[model samples]
Target: MLTIAPAQAPSAADLWAVLTALRLLDDAAEDAAAARIEAARLTDETRWQAAGPRRLRQALTEYTVHLARLADELWFQRDQIARNALG
Candidate 1:
């Protein structure tokens, strides 16, 4: 599948919505990263523990991976808009 999404220049209202969505997506990615960091710290705190902390780390790993992918996709779309506008 194509990783980049095409973009169309939006009207003022649509642009606002797009910006808001981008902000939210960025925030989500950041939150996921924070979760992963927290999970790492938790693991460090209990090195021998294999159940809850490991599960939490796994969840954060999944969340961060997915959100980072989404953030990349969204940023690609946003950049496409800039390229279109420039060209």
Candidate 2:
């Protein structure tokens, strides 16, 4: 006969850590959005400038894109954790 063990409930400390992580991820996402907006504004303002500023703006934009993607993944993970916790 095969037997299955019941799932253990998360400890208070474990739940606290998860909640803290979720908050941090939310904050990071907000910061990423803000950075993207600032980058767009700066790029527009420096549109008539020389190549150096343009290159810097391009790099900033690329980094912000990566940050946004990371934030998205974190948020998805947060949601999955919350759902699993509830179950």
Candidate 3:
């Protein structure tokens, strides 16, 4: 929640503008990446104990890799878009 300063009261347009400027879209990718990594580590550790050492951890390993790759691709595209817009 953003509080409007007494000196700079926000208008209806300002509030609407904030709605359009959703920051979560940009953060989603990074959040997914971190979540994936943490999930994978925990899953792998759990599996290692479950039945001795295993080569694969279905729940976490695959998702972790996928998420990391997705984050890289998303950020890369975002940066490229910014550069293109500026140039």
Q: Considering every candidate listed, which one attains the maximal lDDT?
A: 2
**Stretches of candidate 3 above 4 Å error?**
1-25, 48-56
TM-score to true structure, per model: 0.51, 0.69, 0.55
Clashes of each: 0, 0, 0
Alpha carbon lDDT at 41, candidate 2: 72
Order the candidates by TM-score, highest first. 2, 3, 1
lDDT, ranked from best to worst: 2, 3, 1
> Which candidate wins on TM-score?
2
1-87: candidate 3 lDDT, tens digit per residue: 997876655678865554434344358777877888797777757646454344446646777888888888767765665454333
Off by over 4 Å in 2: 1-6
Candidate number with the higher lDDT (2 or 3): 2
For model 1 the TM-score comes to 0.51
Pairs that collide, model 1 = none
- lDDT of residue 7 for candidate 3: 65
Give the worst 10-residue stretch by lDDT in candidate 3: 16-25
Global lDDT of model 1: 0.63
